[model samples]
Target: MAVSFVQRRFMSNALQKWAYNLSGFNKLGLMRDDCLYENDDVKEALRRLPQTVVDERNYRLIRAVQLSIQKDILPKEQWTKLEEDVMYLQPFLKEVKKEREEREAWNKQY
Candidate 1:
């Protein structure tokens, strides 16, 4: 059972790496999280991010846009590696979602 679990984990990681590379956003120096659609949840999460992280995100986005306009990708050595693509907004997003759900529940109780 443990062996199967390990195999599955390895396969899942491989598949994720394959899909990440295929997405091509890394070529523009953006992380996987940076490519997520900026819906309400994402916007709120971004708003809650620390200033430094927010600035870094904005920098990456602006650079990506510039590269796109020039029809170019980042240098191969500068691409975002899958290992470095941390889900920086996930904690904030989770908090926002939990609060929203609690608010909804309270409204239902009233």
Candidate 2:
């Protein structure tokens, strides 16, 4: 028996979400994507985001940093809720990765 794509994705997302909450970055007003290291793919994704989104991401990071230095997290009311912490950069990253893979595959065809 083989697991289906949707099922696999669902399980993977569940685990990811569980890990995200367990990591507690969201408690400090940081999204899961914010915790991602600044790799080339993430940089590309950030470049593709709209100005407003970029500003918001910056604000979140700054706030998180301030909270860390102060030895506190955002107030419970200010903490990023799990449902609200969407993967804003993931779609763009996926697109960038797909393009990279396609380019690699194309180059190999020569």
Best by TM-score: 1
Error of 2 at 98 (Å): 0.3
Q: For model 1, what is the C-alpha lDDT against the true structure?
A: 0.91
- Model 2 vs truth, CA RMSD: 5.2
Residue-level lDDT of model 1, residues 1-110, one tens digit each, is 25798899999999998998899999998986788799988899999899999999999999999999999998999999899989998899999999999999999999
- True-structure Cα RMSD, model 1: 2.4
| lDDT scores of the candidates, listed in order | 0.91, 0.89
- How well is each residue in 20-69 modelled by candidate 2, as lDDT tens digits? 67888988899888989898888998999999999999999998899889
Candidate 2 wrong stretches, greater than 4 Å: 1-20
Q: State every prediction's TM-score relative to the real structure.
A: 0.87, 0.79
Give the lowest summed-lDDT range of ten residues in model 1: 1-10
